[model samples]
Target: MNQIDLGGKIVVITGGAGGIGQAIAQRALASGASVCSWDNAPTAAQATAGIASMQVDITSEAAVTAAYADTIAKFGRIDVLVNSAGITGPTLTVQDYPLDAWLKVMAINLTGTFLCSRAVVGGMVQNGYGRIVNMASVAGKEGNPLQSAYSASKAAVIALTKSMGKELAKVDVRVNCIAPAMIESALLDQMPASKRAENLAKIPMGRAGTVDEIAAMALWLASEECSFTTGATFDASGGRATY
Candidate 1:
């Protein structure tokens, strides 16, 4: 819990109502930043002081655009964007996976990231300062069984981070992503019990990571201290990721 100063910064965290997203929002607030959490299903708890919550579907172009406008109206500008909204589609073999489910997963995980990232680029570039930390997964690095859609979508997120990072390389904006193994969060509950156990067993630490650990990494990436690194995937896989 080393201190990272984010004074006077305004952060927008998608999926801010969820476990990991919420943690990041709270951390940012504690770091002296104003936070606006955008989620499709916002919660009462997100009504915390210093945080503005918006019900937004990142998958919709219009919704994303509107959210950006509202955010700008509220905060004047966005300093950080954490694309944490995501889903792990149903657990099933590729042949048994529903087409609709696959599409839905891609829509939320990959397309949503793209839309949100696009929404903030203009403002960030104009301001000459921005930090984008996308939430990817170790599964994206090493494909997991019964998680085809989730894996594929996150892989695309990693690629998108790289592309955006390079596009803004000459600017002060820095784009990066986190590839966490099996973080203990509500999303992990979506996996079958056996599958969860299998994934945890692969980690040398022999335990799932916590929301705080991921939040710490995110907070640093969002800070000025993270300079000199862009288009990179920071691993928080508990020793699960080899490369």
Candidate 2:
């Protein structure tokens, strides 16, 4: 693995317990960055010496605030943030989608991202250095037929990243997001087989992306090398992202 220099960086990854999030944590640790994983539950993977875990419900402002405080107390400062917490709501036409389900998905996928970002930006601004990598999806770029809630949430993430990036343009903080196509992870298990097949068919690569692949791009964005680009969308869609 190519290592990007992150010797003293402290990274906070939301949804860090998940497959992709864990992958990011591992890579960041490998590159010499101290990592803290924030998730609603503990991750199955054991935390190494340079790694820590915190239980946080991203959707709750109070919880997120407390998590940030804990993180700062432990690490002294936060240099990078990876907002990878999200859920793919059930596949259903908009007309038939349940309102409760929609709200739940929105709360977790979109609002959670906003809250976490909001909590960290101030610290980053104070420190005058930060890197934020939000996880968006190809579904946001090309709206999926039966996944209205998930698609819309991601689309908002893209827009949010752009706005935040611009707001922090004058500062050293850079905000960006990734639009990955169907990735082969536990997330795919949430979808029906038919839905999974449909998503795969849309990928020109004729296959799903891997957690490490997405993590690589995320690590690059979180590194000092990503100097000029902020509020930009990095595509990991495998020929699927048209724009």
Candidate 3:
């Protein structure tokens, strides 16, 4: 990985126990940032020497607030926040999608992001610097069939990033998101065989992306080099994104 300095920055990544979140934590440590993972299953995070872990349920207001407080107490401050905690609800047609499932997805994917970002923005503003990298999806850009809840929640995340980015434009807090196509991870394993096949067929690269590739893009967005770019959606769709 090409070096992008994040020395001395404190980064908190939701869902840091696994998948893309875990990959980003590794990268952040390598880049010299103090790392913390706020995951519901904190123990799942790799037992690394430099990384801190907090058990947080991002969907609960109280849980998120307490977790943020714990993070600040442990690291002194938060410089970057990665809202990567989300779940893909059961694949079904709109009419057949369970209301409970829809609500759960919205609660975790969208509401959780809002709570975590809200918790950190004040500190960032006070300190005059911040970076937020939200993990959205290509499903939000081009709606994936049978994944209404997932698509809608991610779409909201993209919009939220835009709004927050503009609101803090005068300050140093930059907010952005990544729209990745089908990635080779447990999230993909959640899909049925046919659904996975259909999604991968859309990528011109003829394959799903790796966690490392997504982490690399996220690392850049969380760095000082990302200055001048905010409220933007970076596409990591492997040639699937046209706009």
Number of clashing pairs per prediction, in order? 0, 0, 0
Q: Global lDDT of each model?
A: 0.95, 0.94, 0.92
For candidate 3, what is the TM-score? Answer: 0.98
Candidate with maximal lDDT = 1
Report the C-alpha lDDT of model 2 over 57-101, residue by residue, as the tens digit.
Answer: 999999999999999999999999999999998999999999999
> Candidate 3, 220: how far from true, in Å?
0.6
Which one wins by lDDT: 2 or 3?
A: 2
Whole-model alpha-carbon lDDT for candidate 3: 0.92
If candidate 2 were superposed on the true structure by all CA atoms, what would the RMSD be? 1.0
Clashes in model 1: which pairs? none
Model with the higher lDDT, candidate 1 or 3: 1
Error of 2 at 14 (Å): 0.3
Ranking by lDDT: 1, 2, 3
lDDT of 1 by residue, 1-243 (tens): 698999999999999999899999999999999999999999987895557999999999999999999999988999999999999999999999999999999999999999999999999999999999999999898889899999999999999999999999999999999999989899988989999989999999999999999999999999998899999998999999979
Candidate 3 at 151: error in angstroms? 0.4
